[model samples]
Target: QQQQQQQQQAAAGGDGGQMTEFSIALPAACAQYIVGTNMVNIPTLSKFGAALTLLRDNISGDVVFSYKGSPSAVAESRTLLMHGMNMFGVEIRRQQALLQEQLQA
Candidate 1:
């Protein structure tokens, strides 16, 4: 039951990984809308152009996904998670910069 809960959390965070048998199977329409044809959605009432600008300035700036599990697990899965996020339309390099800042803080 505990494992299932953790799996749920991972999937909710867009982690479609097998290490924990987790994934959110987004519908085709939803997936396309999220990643758009060329970009990810900021998902606000603002216009798409404004949303793009906001994301450009800061993606997940006020938000962060912290690792709170086994260090060994993170060591093994961090690269995979990064790759998966990149594939799913996240601006990972930028986010990584933010993550580094957070870690330093």
Candidate 2:
């Protein structure tokens, strides 16, 4: 009976991986911009069996990004998300500088 119960639990995912979560808080301005972007559709996340959620944190008036999955998956997703955000920021800054130069010209 014990062995059968264990098997049943395993089959039902009750004894599966330890679900892990990672959360990041972003400034409201950046968070609003991210909300309109396609950053959530990361293909690598599905490959790692991870999911991401974004919400406005009312108390802090910030944006909260939550990643849930196995520990390793969550870590990898965090790394990817941060890298993407950094690259996007750099590009946006470069474009703004270029536009400013054009305007001054």
TM-score of each: 0.24, 0.51
Model 1, span 61-90: residue lDDT tens: 332222333344544434443444456555
lDDT of each: 0.42, 0.61
Writing each residue's lDDT as its tens digit, candidate 2 over 3-97 gives 88767766787643357787776665555444436754665443422112334332236555666765666777788768767866887899899
Cα error, residue 40 of model 2, in Å, equals 2.7
Worst 10 residues of 1 by lDDT: 39-48
Off by over 4 Å in 2: 1-16, 43-61
Q: What is the lDDT of residue 78 in candidate 2?
A: 84
RMSD of model 1, in Å?
15.6
Q: Each candidate's root-mean-square deviation in Å? A: 15.6, 7.7
Best by lDDT: 2
